[model samples]
Target: MRYEEELIDEVREKNDIVDVISSYVSLKKRGSNYVGLCPFHNEKTPSFSVSRDKQMYYCFGCGQGGNVYTFLMEYNRLSFVEALQELAKRAGVELPEREQTAEEKQQADARLTLRDMNKEAAVYFHYLLKSKRGTQALVYLKDRGLSDEMINQFGLGYADIYRDDLYQYLKAKGFSDYQMKESSLVNIDTVKGNYDKFFNRVIFPIMDINQRVIGFGGRVMGEGEPKYLNSRETILFDKGRNLYGLNYAKRSRSKSLILCEGYMDVISLHQAGFTNAVAPLGTAFTPNQAMLLKRYTNEVILSFDSDGAGVKAALRALPILRENGLRGRVLSMKPYKDPDELIKAEGQEGYQKRIEEAESGRMFELLVLYGQYNQQDPESRTEFIHEIAKKLAQIEEPLERQTYLASAANRFMIRKNDLENLVNRYGLGYQYEKVNEQYKTPPETEERRQEKKKSNKNQPQRLLLTWLVEHPEMYQYIRAYIGADDFIEPLYHSVAIMLFEQLDNEEKINPAAILSRFTDAEEQKEIAAIFNTHLKYGLSSEDEDKALSDVVRKVKLASIEDEMVHTSDIVRWQELLSLKNKMQKFSISRS
Candidate 1:
């Protein structure tokens, strides 16, 4: 309704849901619907079902369902406006410019202003990188094997030795102290006032997937307390949620990403023609980062430092990758400490060969565990063999697990049958543990969004609304006894009112458009479930009438009971008692 309803319909009509989702997920035709693995969660089985007829998708496993716009917004982590713009462009439907309200305009302007400040700051820093003040920084970068082209490509720059350089520059450009502080480019020190956060460092402007400069990473030019510093979490950026060089790396035609440890690693890899490389912004890998990566690529190649800490980092990252259904591999940069050193010694062809030869994540883990134990020692070797079996048990697929079982036995020169017995023993325990975990209660946040409150009253309200959606022609018959107000649950009542209004006006109900009415992602999903709940198929006409009659009575009786609890008027109370009696005989027919 914000834009004309027709405009949204036009956009939706132009871009078919199946066509749009197919680009992201590999869906197979199954009856009238397509099914695939749910991208929102890590599931081996395909439970994500898309309906071509309804122009909607629902994941039976995760229960995340919605129309095409919601699919794009959820999968790409885009805002509704951003999703609209993206779909509009793809559909070739030029959206008419719509005016923003005062409050909305203010918020939009603030975000725009911050991005503008960051852009201006990038230009200024890039200018200074070429200026005399950046001589030392530029020399250091060049010495590190970074070309001038790479420097320009990454928008690499320098923060002058002056503490207030960027602060002064931003202030001169008419940015307020509040804006400067909010941008995270300047720190507020009561003693020093506003000062640049990245002084005496080489700067790397961190861009989002949209190529907007939201934050910055600055490595100290010389020895300092912290060698590298990143902009703190701000309205514009969260380090855990964004990856460095992702703006360019995401465009790589490859289905995988080369994940590195630092900005230089990503830059060097990009410069060496591995433009798919990206790195966390001076933080350990996070689940949010994993989900973000999942949106872009199915696999990630871990290119970490070859030092002990690097090995530890890789160990830490593998499980998170597995949890998100990402196929992780370790880059075998053995002779070199990191990707930079490897690339410097061997170049792109060697790196490409290494990438092709990257080990599977489980194998990498086994190798790391192998390094910890001395195979020459009898006790250490026995423990290492047990560890391999335990890890192999964790692999849920029998074909994959059995293949690893043989590989581990041959690779370690252990008896295949002996190892197989230990794996089977561990696999049983793992299976038991997994089954137990499934029965444990979900977190409260998930409960709130997925299933708000399930009760006897809730079920009837939910079913009645769903009934109206699937059989709108039945609304006229059902309206004689129960109305939208009788569907007491707030969300259900709101939806019922809309359904009735649309029906009264003689317009076909658009469930997807109704979903557009709720902007909050959680509410949209909850609303989607009202229509998405599977109705019993192949019902006898008599059975259908009985089901509808029963649902209507239940909803009406519950609504009356709820009203009786709150009513203060004696006359209204008397009417409610009489209405309660009238409700007991309430029944409707298909005719």
Candidate 2:
């Protein structure tokens, strides 16, 4: 069973849509609604709109629209129950105790069990690190300049060389073998039952944003085949979705995040007073990680190693940051290997100086281009100028693009006007202008408008859905005349079925309530677009009835035509024709 309807209603009543959305988005008053840049997608113009009266939000740019519950679910990546629990707390509504379903209970138990196992394992590893067995690992950490306080604070530990050391420890702690295997801390051995996953390694506990130890990273103390081994993906841990040291970095409250390469680099940076530092979990940066950073900071300073591989990784991350609507800067940690080495050699103050001297995304790209081509060679220089100009032309802001163009011209010993002419001649300027205009409207809204211009094919079906949602009382009247199968588009048919179902159960049939039926974000956005586009026209009660009848006729005619195409028999084809004629007659009579 879910939360009581009364409790859900109470929570919804207290949490106004506008108020809830304004916390994440800077909504500006526009008519009776609010408009802001969509948090779901990157865009310069404000296509995300909120309707206070309707308690719904729709982004014209990315097509993300839903109620406050949906906003929490999508924005925070929470489950429905999780979103509900959070909103109830914020709304000062107490959620009544309800017995969890078998599946819910099982999932909850699994998460708690895995987390407990990880915590216990971390404690055991820490204990071993302080014991005689970990003396070598402790000395190694000390030699690397990690103070005792840093070691204790980071919960650094050491795994024993014996495969069954942690397994026996956890077993003694009353954890079952199944639980151990599930935690990814132990590997199941066919003959031996279970063995520790990490052996003779330094342990680094990987915590979630909530500070719960969800997983672990183990680094081989000395020479080993695999230098570092991270926890496998589990229910509580997704390496692509979670960043190392974010739990601490978020507490730094810095305006910018220092993105590093590895776990040690992040820990070392934090030790050197750069607390707002995070790293991916033994993997290259991902789009999900980029979006996660955008939630915390507006800008990211890429402090990857200055080595060739690190440079390539930093270059690859630039576009991901841009696509996620986060500004990026490249930190050139030259004359050193990584942040850990740089901090050790130059100290925190020297590292701060390097951060300040970091290059902008465009300038960094130019620098990378310059490194690839020697300036003395005329052919390489020409190719470099053309490539740099193309990059500059892609810059959306005119001033920023012009500044970069000037910098490129000065660097290449060419006139600024000549570069500008070249960029314009390449048609990059026109393409940029087109993209800028496209961002002003939601992609779905534009496509719908273009579809309308192309033909009146799906217009009536879309109109029927909008009218039914806006006027739920008409559902019964419309149901008497037509069924969901009459609708041509699958999306429209789905919406029609949901609308009738909600009305049949005597429930509210607004966009928010209707959207809750769908789990897919894209499907919810599509339904929102259906309501958002047609509702703007403001059809009256009398107009709604007439429009509904006309649309039903059109939908029935479209459905019949579709059936006729498959009707090979002359009798079946004639039957479809007669059905279409009957629909036309009924529509004429209703009019």
Candidate 3:
């Protein structure tokens, strides 16, 4: 019913899945299917397959498969609607306007309002920083040794100490008080009911990956209890997810990512030509942030404040980096309180030397340092060892664990044997392995598990689908014997059913025809990923068909077993009653 759905269907109807994917992959026609290397994961052999009659794709190596929409979602990392719109544009399908629900309309309106407010706030603060009102802030930055270029690159700004200044500015610009409050740009007094949270402070805009200003952090210029104020959580941003200067860092280099503790540190470092640097926005490093870093580079350098708190944060972050498969090192600078000061006091050269000379301390050493600094004694040591052991256990490599065990033993002055034994006692490795195994089956408790399972189970069927789309002539031999209903898994079954019904109804097969019928955005993406996986790795046709048949049979048997279990529960009582009645009849007849 939607425009993208219709457009996708048209594209699928006109184009052959194999031919479309062939543009991306080098495919060879092997009887009924095509085979290629899988694009999802790094593999040498060709396990990806496409079926001309099925209009689907499957990657046997990685078990990735779906339709054209799924292909785009995985390859391009585009959302469902975005992928649909893109594919539609490619296929020359004109789409109609979509109807928005009431909730959708409201959310859209709120987002627009928040975006406008953030832009206005950013502009106002930047203007203040340049004007006479911001003389103190300018002097503050100058004293901190930040260059004009650095300030501009970071879009640093200032907010005056006037009550309701931001409120008034936004109000005149047509933003309501409610919008300002919701935007987190200004705060309302719980007691007085109206106030600005960021008065008399230098403001720093928090940006997302797309460089959209999502939130702000304000440093109090004068003597204040807190000294810093950050924007509350909003729709566009979470303090944990948005890293400072990552948008800039990701663009410059891909070799190494520098994780700093503060925005000023990142800005100053970037100005010093250390461009690959970013910091979490007013929060500790999170797993999401760690995963984000992994995408850009496996090598990471953690540079926190030289204070105890900074060291502790680095220690906490070590296991996270390790867990995410990041090659990370901790840089312990002079106890100069903060990174901005050290960089300012000692020029880039000095900081660079310190960074290079930094000792590569394992996570356990950092934790020991943390414990020592915090003065955690006897009882705390017990809790501490358990914590550190758990963190160490997350390291999946046996060699890596042994390496860290030595480090832990040396730092704690305990025997290497005792420490190694303690680390093993925690069972962190076993827990991680269990979790890893659970992940292989697509997590049963996950809300989307059914879809994930179907995707996983129907990889071979997807290959057939892709081949059918690319080589429709192959459909004749398989059409009568196979239909969508034959597939046990929904993804394969659904695609099969769609193809069978379409060809049966229309008396012809077209890969692009039913794309529009895939209205679910998530499913569309799954299909795109599936297709992209196959196309990225070209495969031969015959092998694809054989793989599909084998998987289909396995899935059907599993489905039958599942049904038998369910039916057995229902018939259990009837069997018991029948046996009892037979015994009674036998006894009565004998008497």
Candidate 4:
């Protein structure tokens, strides 16, 4: 069962929407509402609005709107239950323990089972690392400069040579085969049955932000073709969405994050007291991971290996970090392969110094480009200058772009105007429009464009829905005349049906309450757009009545016209014409 309605009401009352949103966004008072740039999307203008009286927020640019719960769910990517728990904590509301419904219970059990299985596997592997079976692995870790305390803190463990040791242990512990497979800890063979996914390797448990063990990574102790093996994508784990050691890194309270290339680099950095270090899980950095990092720190330092592949990876990550509004810097690890080797040779202080001396992303890219060609060669210099111009053009700030342009001119001994022109030609600063000479709006083509223009045409329907929700007493009168079938747009249709049903059930027509009925983010956005749209002209009681009558007539006329197009028989066409005539007469009478 869900939380008690009284408790939900109390939570909502205590946690005002403006107060909650103000913590994440810098909202400024604009009339009765607060306005800020949208956190969901990158924008310069303040299109996100929060209403103190209505207890809701809406982004006109992105169309994301809802109450505090919707904001938490979208901004933090949390589930409804998770958002509720978070709000309950903030509101200081004591939640009564209740029994879960069968479906909820099953889902909770599945997640708990996976977490418990991973925890047990971590423990079992840790024991093996300390046992005689893990002697060589322990020696290997020691050679890599890992102390016993550091190993224990990181939950480092070893999987023995036996293929099904973990499999047998988990099975004996009463874990179901399905749970094990779902956890991605065991692989099921068609003929061989189930076997451990990690063997003859040292295991590193990957955890969620809450520090719950979700998956594992294993590095082979001895020589192997594939030296590192990570958990496959499963219900509990997505490799691209997770970063290794983030659970610990976030607690460092550091102003910046050190994004390394591998598990060892992150672990080594943490062991060296630079706890704010995280690495992607066996894949290149992703936009999701970049956005996640933006939540923890304002700056990110890329500390990949000093190899060609690592430089390329860093280059790719630069734009992603910029897109997510995080400052990215590059740590030059030349004369050393990675952080692990650098820390091993020069200690923590040396690594810290290197971090301090790290260059900005643009500077790093320029340096890398400079190394590719000799300046004495005229053709190579031209190509290099153009490449630098393209990179400089991507910088949005005028002052920043000017600074880079000046630097480039000084370095290449070229006129800054030539480079600026090249940047405008190749970079995002360039604006080009193509004219289509054969563009024509046929019936089918117009229908295709209807989705874009539906917002304008359906304004009356949206206003009617909004008015019905704002004045539930009017729902009875509106319901007698119109139904959800009158709404042409699916989004508005869904909202109308929900509003009618909610009114019939005597439920409050609140944004939060209405939002709870929807699970899709897109649907929530549309609902927010409907709620945020303000009527151009004021609707007094008399005006509201006329507006409702006019909208109903318009809807009926549209319905008739739509039916007339589909009607094949003479009788159906005549009936549609009669309905249209009656709607027009009713509209005239109401006016």
Question: Candidate 2 vs. truth: CA RMSD?
Answer: 7.0
Q: Which tens-of-lDDT digit does each residue in 359-427 have in candidate 1?
A: 999999998889899999999999999999999999988899999889988988999999999999999
Q: Arrange candidates, best lDDT first.
A: 1, 2, 4, 3
RMSD of each: 5.1, 7.0, 12.2, 6.9
lDDT of 4 at 473: 77
Worst 10 residues of 1 by lDDT: 448-457
RMSD of 4: 6.9
Question: How should the candidates be ordered by TM-score, best one leading?
Answer: 1, 2, 4, 3
Over 4 Å off in model 4, which ranges? 4-79, 92-97, 223-225, 234-236, 416-494, 497-512, 519-554, 557-580, 584-591
Greater-lDDT candidate between 3 and 4: 4
lDDT of each: 0.85, 0.81, 0.69, 0.81
Which whole-number lDDT from 0 to 100 does residue 327 have in model 1?
93
Per-residue lDDT tens digits of candidate 3, residues 145-235?
8899888878899999897888888889998777777888767676886777788999999887788888899999889856777898876
TM-scores, in order shown? 0.78, 0.75, 0.57, 0.74
Model 4: how far residue 197 lies from native, Å: 1.8
Model 4 local distance difference test score:
0.81
Task: Pick the TM-score winner.
Answer: 1
Name the runs in model 2 displaced over 4 angstroms. Answer: 9-77, 91-99, 189-193, 427-480, 483-509, 517-581, 584-591
lDDT tens readout by residue for model 4, 406-513: 887787677978887888777654322111211323355665678668666877778777776666777666565567777867777777787778788887776666
